[model samples]
Target: MSGHAAFAVTVDLAVFTIRDGIFSVLLVERGTEPFAGSWALPGGFVEADEDAETAAWRELREETGVERFEGHLEQLRTYSAPDRDPRMRVVSVAHVAFAPDLPAPAPGSDAANARWWAVEDLLDGGPDAPPLAFDHATILADARERIRAKLEYTTLAREFVAEPFTLPELRRVYAAVWGSPPDLGNFRRKVLGTDGFVVPTDTHGVSASGGRPALLYRRGEATDIQPPMLRTAGEDD
Candidate 1:
């Protein structure tokens, strides 16, 4: 085992949510060295006795203080570039998590601050975009694409809304992720036609603008869309 290199393992999370129709991700300002003061995905080194997923959840709770989450959480991929971490050889197991509009986060001891940033603003290469620490920008971009693709053929969209939600609420989740809204009529038909995608309830949701109340629904038993709700160009207009 002579001359064998030792590496550290970490877990990075791309925790996403839709707030006021804008898709956002949780980021923290690193308080320590290597990227001090830079914003990065909320994560940290994996513990010696825990798995990657457990570390991901732990980091999420510690960095963001999100204890009650009822949404999707899954492993995205791994990053093991030799130069990824300037300090030493490090490999990261990335995870993608989705939740409904989450509350403001309290930064943990390792972070200077924590807040939600619009995913578009971070990836748009604008002057206002804060530079991400390490390789988080790449991990976030990949996670965004994964959510967008999954929304096309899965009930993953439901993870963005609370139960007993209206169709409009669900539609907005798609709009937030896809960067545009789907056609109202087409979206309704597709969702209703796709059995088990949603279960209608007798109650209706009150419109804030005094419009007619909309029917309420909850996520159903199905996980896959039958024909798949494919996004099309100019469908929003």
Candidate 2:
């Protein structure tokens, strides 16, 4: 084992949620060096005894104070470029998570601040965009596309809504992620026709404008959407 090189493993999370009709991702301002004061995905080095996923969840709670997450979580990819982290040789296992109406974040010990940033603004490379630390800009972009693609054929959109949500509410989730609203008539037909995609309940949601009450529904038992709600070319623009 003499002359063997050593490297550390870390976990980075792209925690996404729809906030105020905008697709947002959680970010933290680094409190220490390597990228001090720059924005980055919430994460930390994995402990010797824990796995990457466990480290992800642990860092999530420790950094964001989101103790209860009832949504989707999965490994996205890994980054192991020798120079990705300036401090030392490090490999990062990135994770993607989604939920609805997450609470405001309080910065963890290693962060100066924490908040949600619209995914488009961050990825747009505009004047207002914060320079992301490490390779997180790439990670965020990948996570954004992953969620968008999943919505086309999977019931992943349901993770962004609470139970007993209306069709309009569900459609908004699609709009927020895809950046364009799917046609109302087509969206309704596709959702209702897709077996086990959603289950109707006896309850209704009151509209803010005092309009007629809309029927509410909960996510059903099925995971895949039959016939696949494909996103067309112009729908993303």
Candidate 3:
């Protein structure tokens, strides 16, 4: 087999969370070239005899030391830039995972250290911090767009939220993405009217509003978010 015909496979990860109302992603500081000292998603070369997605899962655990990958995990895209890795022609299989919270984020393997960076911080990251390795900037961008879109169409937003959430709490998730307050009446109608979107768990009921501690609800198994929660325009300002 010709050596030139063989290709290198690398896996990059996008681990995201929302803290204090700001969306954030996990990143590591690279020690080696091809963008050394710069923050990049946790990932590495695929182990020999390992499958691509398997490699992604393993690399994610090794690099992030997370307990599990049971939540929403999906392949974001493949990056095959010839110069992605200066030492060889590397192809990266990128993946993204959404976690609700964290205990800690310590850098593992090639990274000097790992930390959760506020998406706003990164979005506002100036040219001075350090350039990202490979096309990680693009990878993170893709993950974010998917997250935003999915939160609208699926009951997926619940995964990021806690159970028995106050209507106000649930509304906040929408405000985070849409950046606007939803009409109280319309928003409530859409969410409650939608079958399987949420199930009222409290037997008697309590209102979220101080009025009566409105009905407490839990996440329902229904996967589809019917009558989709459409927000008013000017949603990303």
Candidate 4:
């Protein structure tokens, strides 16, 4: 390992949250050179005293005004392509997180502005869409695919909702994330038939519009989803 050049480490966050029934991700406008005036994910250099996860959370809080985030924050992957960044040799540890709702964000640290953009719009990728700086576009795409894949084999979808949720409400989470609606009857059957998928809360939720009360449920102890919900043709059923 002798004679090798030193490199710097940083963290980039793709924070996705469901707000007003829309799936969105947090973004910050770049305020520094090497792509100034461009939209990008919230992130920064990792301090010498901080670990990768800690640095990610710190940057998330600092840039997006999230003092305390309640959701899953997992390391998506590391990006080390030689020319991915300019100015120096830097490696980024990308992270992805999910939450029910997040407070409005303000510009902080080196970010010129912080805002939430609809995941659909971000994925559209056209001349009219907001462009991402650096390799952030790739990072965001990877993070999104990771969450969609997780939904097939894990209870991670429950993270997008609060407790005492109804079947219809839970189904919407899948639709929003997958960008397509799942058949209600088939979805209900699959969820209920799967052992330890969800447990009834012995309570009902009243609709604000004065309709029939819907049964409520809470997450079960199961982590893996038996008979996974695949996106392939003839697999959803």
lDDT by residue for model 4 over 47-70, one digit each (tens)? Answer: 999999999989978877777677
- Model 1, position 109, has a per-residue lDDT of 64
Which ten residues in a row are the worst by lDDT in model 4? 228-237
Error of 4 at 143 (Å): 0.2
* lDDT (Cα atoms) of all candidates against the true structure: 0.88, 0.88, 0.73, 0.85
TM of each candidate vs. truth:
0.88, 0.88, 0.83, 0.89
Ranking by lDDT, best first? 1, 2, 4, 3
Q: Clashes in each model (backbone N, CA, C under 3 Å)?
A: 0, 0, 6, 0
| Local lDDT at 157 for model 4 | 84
RMSD of each: 3.0, 3.0, 3.7, 2.4
lDDT of the structure predicted as candidate 2: 0.88
Task: Give the range of the ten consecutive residues with the poorest summed lDDT in model 1.
Answer: 228-237
lDDT of 1 at 215: 95
* Clash pairs, model 1 backbone: none
Residue-wise lDDT of candidate 2 within 169-211, one digit each (tens)?
8999999998898887768877898888999999888878998
lDDT for position 58 in model 2: 89
RMSD, model 1, all Cα superposed? 3.0
The sequence of per-residue lDDT tens digits that candidate 1 reaches over residues 47-146 is 9999998888888888778774778888999999999999999999999988876889999868889999999999977667899999999999999998
